[model samples]
Target: MDSLILNILTPVAIFLFIALFTLFAVYAERKIAGFVQDRLGPMETGKYGLLQTFADILKLLQKEFISPSASDKILFALAPILIFVAVFVGYSVIPWGPNLIPSNTHTGLFFIMAVVSIDAIGILMAGWGSNNKYSLLGSIRAIAQMISYELPVGLSLIAAVMITQTLNLNEIAFNQGLLSSKEIYFLGFWKVNEIGGIFGWNIFQAPHLMVSYAIFFIASLAECNRAPFDIPEAESELIGGFHTEYGGIRFAFLFLAEYAMMFLVAMLGVVIFLGAWNSPLPNIGPAKLADWTTGPVWGVFWTLIKSLFIVAVQIWIRWTLPRFRADQLMTLCWKILIPLAFVCMAISGLWRILIMI
Candidate 1:
């Protein structure tokens, strides 16, 4: 009974968290853009525009739900929910802190990758249902981009999985903490199992993973349909892309899903490459900074900090970089990222073999 209640409450809590996070993230991105463009972003809504997102949410809630006259009503209405659910369900396996995962599946990483891919189907549905040429083109671009990038994302994750030898995300996170059961080494030389910090992280344990992390990060940016890789939603060209015909609450869900995807991918990167919730500061001599700062609560703190930092970088890149032409985007994924990802995988295999020898 308790377990059943917990399951019910967990999703409710996560839903609330996502809603609140979207509010903060939207406001934060506006401020960040303001800083980048040398303009005040939202000073009028509520001191520093703190309430701007809230105001926008209320407005969206009040707006009339509008659909194209000839649109497929059923699919058009269902697409946003599908898109949002695809991204939302991926959160189940995320390790928020020590034993804090909502669902600690043995195949956690694999599950997330699989479920998140469903967003492509949702996008395609939205486009096709809308019966808009622009929306269809956008969905086509999104599908191709997502499918192409999935290769590098999967290969890079496989590289990390080879090093960890486990598919459990909780275990992967634990392996980077001080209490890890397995011995950790710094650069495959000095043992750092006792030193638990940045040294115990996968990238440091196997330096080649730095390349893998880079590939993962770039592939994730594309997966999230973020800028440079955001041709699917190019405002100037597609006028809001696959969601062109959506309005009111349906559009809000799509918008929420995009930001949620940003956070989701960022958190995944943190868990896989950035030590999850583990402290970066190592225990040295009597300092014991890592020991002092690691616990269930601290775990949540560190995970959020690292993940948010990545999200900030994503936002920065959005404003700083130009959107990639569709051809350039596909070429980067197929020619560049996929090749590097393969090399990373090969190197991981060799590293594991050498360690055993």
Candidate 2:
């Protein structure tokens, strides 16, 4: 009974958190775009159009239910929901705080990558099921992009997991904090201090860790089908990617899933490299608090803050970089990211062997 209640409560808590953050992300993305382009984003809905996404959802729900005449009625209707659920489940294994994790699987890292990576299959289904030409082309492009990028992303993560020597997300946190607990004195000026566990994040751990961070972030952007990598759904070219024929609440589900996955990747990044939920400074945050406060809540708070920052950065990158051509996208992944990740993995293996020696 107690475990049941905890499980129920945990999901509700996380769902609410993801919902609110996503709403904020939607508004912020628009606002940032407006600011960057020297124009107003949403001035009428609520405070700075804070209610813009809510308004958009309501509007979408009320919009026409029209699908293409040639579209597969059942799949056109189901694809958005399917895609949404795929991204939503990816959130389960992510730890928000110290022990504030929802579902802590032994193979948490593998579980996350697997779930997120396979979402490309859903894209393929959605695009092909739609029976629309642009939808088909976009889905094909997305699958190719996902396939090419997943290699580098997975390999880059191998570097971190090798260093930490664990598959558990919380254990990954502990590993990072352990690294943060003792900073290697690099040239007497660079002090990568240990915070606790997740607080140290991952980027500060080693020279290669930073490279992994860059590699992971870029590959993540592609994996999520975000811009400049959003070529799969280029509005001008692909109409809407695999979702070109979706409408009303169905289309909204696609939008929701995209943002949710973005947040999930951010959270995963936080846990793997950003110290689960540890603060950045040396003993300045709750990680320095007594064991009680330093436990889950502080970790959760820091983790959210770190994740929010990453999401915002993702949004920023979207507005800054232009979309890539499908060919250009595939080339970047195979010709560049994959080889770099290969080298990173080799270096990670060598580093571990030396440490053991």
Measured by TM-score, the strongest candidate is 1
Give the alpha carbon lDDT tens digit for every residue of 1-357 in model 2: 999999898878877777777677889999999987899999998877888899987898899888777877777777777777778888788777656677877898998888876687778878978898899999998888888888888999998888777788866775455333334322123443433332345565556777888899999999898999998889987678788788787777787888888988888887887667765545546555433335566677777788889998998899988888767887898898888888888877886677422
Evaluated at residue 328, the lDDT of candidate 2 is 85
What's the count of clashing pairs in each model shown?
0, 15
Ten contiguous residues minimizing lDDT sum, candidate 1: 348-357
Q: Write the per-residue lDDT of candidate 1 for residues 1-357, one digit (tens) a residue.
A: 999999999999989988998999999899999999999999998887899999999999999989898999999999999999999999999999988999998999999999999999999999999999999999999999999999999999999999989999999999986979898777778798878989988888888899999999999999999997999999999998998998888989999999999999999999998999999999999999999989999999999999999999999998889999988998898899998899889988898889734
Count of backbone collisions within predicted model 2: 15
lDDT of each: 0.92, 0.77
Candidate 2's C-alpha runs over 4 A off are 178-200, 284-293
Q: What local lDDT score does residue 174 receive in model 1, on the 0 to 100 scale?
A: 95
TM-score of model 2 vs. true structure? 0.90
Q: In candidate 2, what residue range of length 10 has the lowest lDDT sum? A: 179-188
For model 1 the TM-score comes to: 0.98
Off by over 4 Å in 1: none
What's model 1's overall lDDT?
Answer: 0.92
